[model samples]
Target: MWVEVLGWIIVIVLFAVGMAGTIYPILPGAVAIYAAFFVYGFMISFSPFGWVFWTLQTLIVALLFIADHAVNAWGVKRFGGSKASIVGSTIGLIIGPFVIPAFGLIIGPFAGAVLGELYARSSLEQSLKVGFGSLVGLFTSVVAKIVLQLLMIVLFIIWLLV
Candidate 1:
């Protein structure tokens, strides 16, 4: 009984942290969530949700990981940004949080995209447009991640209850 209780506690904590990680770039949010779920299911011997369900959830996590990058790149390309701009945006994402805390995440990509466009000989207006596009893409990605994460949680709940 004590071991089971401890497991639940750990799972809950991991789920909470994992959800938070989805928003922050530094943490592996999806992976954490998946881990928590995996642990719980393993503890129960996958009684409620079997291998098929587990596999589905795993695929969702994998897709989320890929989608993050694909969507970001799609946004850059959709906004008329060149390869250089995409590279710059990626760099900014990595450097932003460390440089300026919360706001850095938002500003870093925009600035990076603009600089990249400029480097590619784009006019100031065009560079700004690309930057704006990158920002929009980032926002879209966040929304998608949040929704997907919620879905994952809801699925877990349903499986547990059923």
Candidate 2:
């Protein structure tokens, strides 16, 4: 029916946006994708994908959410960043989007980590290293999210076809 076609179109759009969000950090990327799936499943009465698929997707989203933070912290620590640097990076992530928009998200964490290291009385060279580490961590996390998102999409498509 026309309604079903409309639903598919809306879901696809949302999925695309969600995938982009994973890269940009502007939107809840994985969450948005999951929401689309949830809506689709609901519309179809969960007949095919059913509760098991929903549960699997939910777990994937939760794991990715936790991993994002863990990976970032790990990156900072791996680079010998102090506790202050970690705190600074967190603050940068929160404020970057608002301060500089798209690019700010990328720059904010590095700047924040550097500033934090400086505040902790580290040498300038060491602070820069910490900042670089923070940047690396952010990049790693984004890549991980993208891979996971792709897997989710693939699963959705396979389920749809079957």
**Backbone clashes in model 2:** 0
Residue ranges of candidate 2 with Cα displaced over 4 Å:
none
Clashing pairs in 2: none
Candidate 2 C-alpha lDDT tens digits along 50-155:
7777788888999899988888888889999999999999889778888998678878899999999999999999999999999899999989999998888888
Worst 10 residues of 2 by lDDT: 39-48
What shift in Å separates residue 126 of candidate 1 from its native position after superposition? 0.9
**lDDT, model 1, position 64:** 89
Consecutive 10-residue window with the lowest summed lDDT within model 1? 37-46
lDDT of 2: 0.86
TM per candidate comes to 0.92, 0.92
